[model samples]
Target: MKISLKTIIAGGALAAIAALAIAAPAADNWENHCAKCHGADGKGQTKAGKKLNVKDYTDAKVQSEFSDADIVKATTSGISDKAGKEKMKAYKDELSEAEIKEMAGYIRKFKK
Candidate 1:
């Protein structure tokens, strides 16, 4: 059985497309999880954000204060108020290790 040149070209194109799809990273987890408090723009201006007094991730100074490790820890373990009560819910149970690590990088993009 002989394959036509067009068939070979179409197959190659489909393979390339499939490869690109697999290589591309999924949408940031922050949108689904953090955005409610952080805001889609990362300004931390939502009502919950205001109530919790969530820090604006878009602020460069705030971004500089936390290392990537800090971000990862907070994400996995959750944050607390001055009284040591948990304010944020821990994602350690919900997300994978790799996803939590990726979230650290995702949050950094909020910095101006």
Candidate 2:
């Protein structure tokens, strides 16, 4: 079988587009996965957020309390209350490590 240069280039472009689609942007992930509780502005002001008593990512003090690793761990493993009640659902199965790291960095940008 012979593949033309144009064909190969087109195939490569399609592959790249597929990869991009598979790996959603951090903001999109945050909006889809976190905005319900964290709010789109990271202020934790949504109704669900208020009910859950979620922290405000826009607060520098709140941001200072956690490290990037902490964010990764929370996102990958999820958070729970002291009684072992689940708070956040784990995303390790849904998100790649790279995506999780990207999310952590994205969260950092919310600090005021």
Candidate 3:
């Protein structure tokens, strides 16, 4: 069957919109649900993050201390547990493994 120009254009447009729609919501979710505590820039600005002196992902020394695995675990379980405390809320139930990774990668940006 031949693909019509109209069909091709519509399909391409749909794909483009779909891609943006999907990617945007995830980033927004990460920002709204997690950013406040983690800092919009991902430096751990949550009230607890501040009181407990949360790890600064932007710090070269701090970022270097943990591997990618460590970041994902930290996001999923909570920063306090990884660091040995109760300063953070465990997100194991709240967020998926992929989301946790996204948050980690978001924070990793600060390392530079």
User: TM-score per candidate, in order?
Assistant: 0.73, 0.86, 0.62
lDDT of each residue in 13-52, candidate 3, tens digit only:
9999997665445468667676666676768877856876
Per-residue C-alpha lDDT of model 2 across residues 18-110, encoded as one tens digit per residue: 998789999999998899999999999999999999999999999999999999999999999999999998999989999999999999999
Which stretch of 10 consecutive residues in model 3 shows the poorest summed lDDT?
Answer: 20-29
lDDT of candidate 1 vs native? 0.83
**Model 1 lowest lDDT segment of ten:** 20-29
**Candidate number achieving the greatest lDDT relative to the actual structure:** 2
Model 1 Cα RMSD, 1 decimal: 4.7
Segments of candidate 3 deviating more than 4 angstroms: 1-26, 45-48, 79-85
Error of 1 at 25 (Å): 5.6
lDDT against the true structure, each candidate: 0.83, 0.95, 0.73
lDDT of 1 at 53: 89
Model 2 — TM-score against the truth? Answer: 0.86
